[model samples]
Target: MTLAIENGSGKATQWQKVMVVAEPTRESAAALHYVLSRVVFDNDILYLLHVENPTFWKTCFKKQSSSTSREGGGCYGGCIGGDVDFLDQMKSACEVVHPRLKVKVSRVETDAKEKAYVIISETKVHGIDLLVVGKRQSLANAILGQSINGTIRETAEYLVENSKCTCVAVQRKGQTGGYLLHTKTHRNFWLLA
Candidate 1:
């Protein structure tokens, strides 16, 4: 792929809406970084979507509960401080960049399993041109079946297949330093940038 780091190639074009899914994890942070550093260009409206899964407390955090501070008095002050840090960086990036970027944040309440549907609806609502989601992969999907719910991190896969616009599911590839991207056209493609 062309890594020109430019919005449009050979023509003056700007995507109206670019939606990037936001979560508190480092995977999500990397996705946001990818959007801000690589995909976005002048006049693009950036959208940060945080799907607040109502059952996340019960469903997502079990032994991995320590990853996010859902402990100590039920997911309020002790949860998701990474999001605030990310937002601050986002704002700073917008201010520093030459492009006049506009960012909008949305928080939608839904069940964990239906996250893909909610994301798809948001794209339709905003007419998003490109959608970016941080993929949190689970070995359980392979060990168990795709029918499982609690470790339902496969929502990105569903979105890649179903979203009306171009959807990219990003997963950071640890210390090797790369990203694993899933698109309608690509599966587990290693993206160096």
Candidate 2:
């Protein structure tokens, strides 16, 4: 499958279906919905994937086990986590714009690195023409100098460089309601220049 974006001027062009991969986050969900609404296409599919990375829990368990000498050591109370159904949330969110869009949800338990590989592989298996991902913002990226955005950037660059499909990284920006006007004005200025 090949995804092509064409300006809706006066020309004949082929339109391929677009696949959007949205993680279950408020920002990501909002951005996905916004992009889908803005884009005019006949064939489009939205894929929502929830990846549960075990590294966070593994590290937490390791730290708790090392601090105590009991056979079953427990420093912090073990509480049940991972019960949140992100896929369900995504489904409900997408249902708001039903009939106009086709949405699919999948839940996978894998680390970030493994998840990235799975996404790439699935893109091929599912005949995805384009891959859309969200850019996450965290304080660690600001202070610790590492973040999910960096991983996404590296992953996107590698995929775009190596794969045959097109990749897009969508970020949630504040709605100014002047983007269209700004772009047109800029274009006019450039033409005059």
- Model 2 C-alpha lDDT per residue in residues 122-147, reported as the tens digit of each score: 77777776665654445654464433
As a whole number from 0 to 100, the lDDT of residue 14 in candidate 2 is 49
Name the lDDT value of residue 122 in candidate 1: 95
The residue ranges of model 2 lying beyond 4 angstroms of the native Cα positions read 2-16, 40-43, 55-84, 137-163, 177-193
Error of 2 at 154 (Å): 4.6
Per-model TM values vs. the true structure: 0.71, 0.56
lDDT of 1 by residue, 68-100 (tens): 433443354114432355555555665576358
| Clashing pairs in model 2, backbone N/Cα/C closer than 3 A | none
- In candidate 2, where is summed lDDT lowest over 10 consecutive residues? 184-193
- CA lDDT scores, all candidates in order: 0.74, 0.53
